[model samples]
Target: MRRATTGLDLALAGLMTVAACAEVVISGGGGTALGFGVAATLLIAFRRRIPLVTACGVTVCLIAESVFVEPPDRAVPMFVLILASFSVAAHANRRDAAFGLSFLSLAMITTGALDAGDDVASLLPGWALFVGIPGGVGVAFRKRTGDVAVMEARAAAAEVAALEAVEAERRRLARELHDVVSHAVTLISVQAEAGQAVIDSDVEGARRALAAIGAASQDAVAELHAMLALLHEPSDESTGSTSTGLADLPSLVAGVRAAGLRVELVTRGVSALPPAADHCAFRVVQEGLTNALRHERNAQVRLVIDHADADSAIRVESRGTRHQSSYGGSGRGIAGLRERVAAVGGSLEVLDHDGTYCLQAVLPR
Candidate 1:
């Protein structure tokens, strides 16, 4: 569009320059009028690049043509005046635009007054209208162009930010899935190995192991469903069904216990929290216990939530195991928990004192 407009400008300036040359040749003017006409025409080529300078140059030409040209009845070089005035408003800054318009309008009025053999009032209005209309139109075009450019820039910026936010959320969900699925699969793998090892010799032990595998599989599926439900637009039924919170911790503990780990849950002065806080608290406990399951076999784990303290806090501690397990992890569990807690305006702390590993989260009410 801009290139097309520039092409149009060049065409207009060329046509106007030819008209200016015709004015000079037809009038059979002296060198002064011809020189002024030529100079004004040449200056139009630079109007887009240096509009103020070109407008001023054309205004000076108009004045010179008025003073020096003979057969003053001919309104010569008026096209250049109008074009320069329009260019000034379209391209120049406020002060330059104002000054250019004023100078060109006054020059037109002055030339009209000097050339008139009749009432100056009749001619003044027509010339003023001629000068003012182009200037006004140019100013309006400039303002509209600027406003549109601003809106477009803001829209582009908003789109980029939205894309960046979606990317960040995908990364967050990836971390979450890694932690949840990894924990469940680890327990299932352990149970499967045990069940296979004692399949014939110990039938009851094999039965219990199979049950644990089933339970782990169910837990993994439930968690995955909850996450998937969260990803879509929530309907009333789905919203109520898949949400997990502090109330679900008992079942979580029961599942962990069934997998042959001892977990103690203790709470004091901890009333029901908001869903986000409750969910974060649940995750902290879940991740802590998962870590214990992987690294500290037969370790005693204590999960504590205390709201009576100045800062409402949940703590998960595991006394180091006498025998470490072969199971390992990518170590994203604690980091994911920390990010989750931080998202809800909470803080997480992990402490290793002597042989005990403690993970604590303090959340604002």
Candidate 2:
């Protein structure tokens, strides 16, 4: 693009030089006028780079031509001056452009006074037509171009922000799906194995296990449908049936108990929190219980939720022998939980000592 622009500028300079030289010769202005015209036209090449200097140089050449040659026709020189004036206003800053215009106007008035003597008043229309109009047009063009550049820059920034927002939302959905599927699958697997082990001797026990599996499957399907609804239509409303909070701890604990893990729940203070923090706290407890179920056999788990003046705390502790046939994990559940807690300005910690494992999180209100 730079090469193309440079080529066009050189082409314009060459064409103007030829036309101005021809005009000088036709008017019989002699060698002096031809030299001045060529010099003025050559300065057009550098107008974009040093517009004020180019304008000043062209103005000097025009004045010199009027004084030395006094050409019969001033058409070419006036046209070159108009082009120079436009370039000055278009490329130069306001102070420099204003100075260039004033200098060119003063030079034109002086040149007209020298040629017409006392009849300088009659040259006002020519001065305005050749210099004033072009300078004003150039200023307007510069302002318009600046406005367009600003709008383009703002549009580019907005596009980048939107892309970032989309990527963040995708990560959030992946995390939610992972938590939901992992917890339900873990419960169903444990219940199915228990039901299979007891099917020969204890029909009632097997039937209860099957019922738990059915319940877990139904819950998972409902949660999945709720998540899918968000993809179809975004909303500011809470996730309705799928949105879990402190009040749902009893049901969560009951489900984990039905899956064969022993959980004792304890609570303190009033459970009041912002939606984001409340949701994060629920995930913390859910992830902690899920990890305990996957890794421990006959584990006694204690879940504690404490709401205080400044923050909310959740702690899950499990004590049991490690399961010989424990389920494998991809290690994303705890990491996702950490991200969720951190997103709401919270901190999570996990500890293991001997046969005991503890998960703790603290969230600001």
Native-vs-model 2 lDDT? Answer: 0.83
Candidates in order, TM-scores: namely 0.82, 0.88
RMSD of each: 4.1, 3.0
lDDT of 1 at 345: 88
For all candidates, the clash counts are: 0, 0
The lDDT values for all models are: 0.77, 0.83
Task: Specify the poorest-scoring 10-residue window by lDDT in model 1.
Answer: 233-242
On TM-score, the leading prediction is 2
Q: lDDT tens string, model 2, 81-107?
A: 888889889988999999888878866
Error of 2 at 332 (Å): 2.9
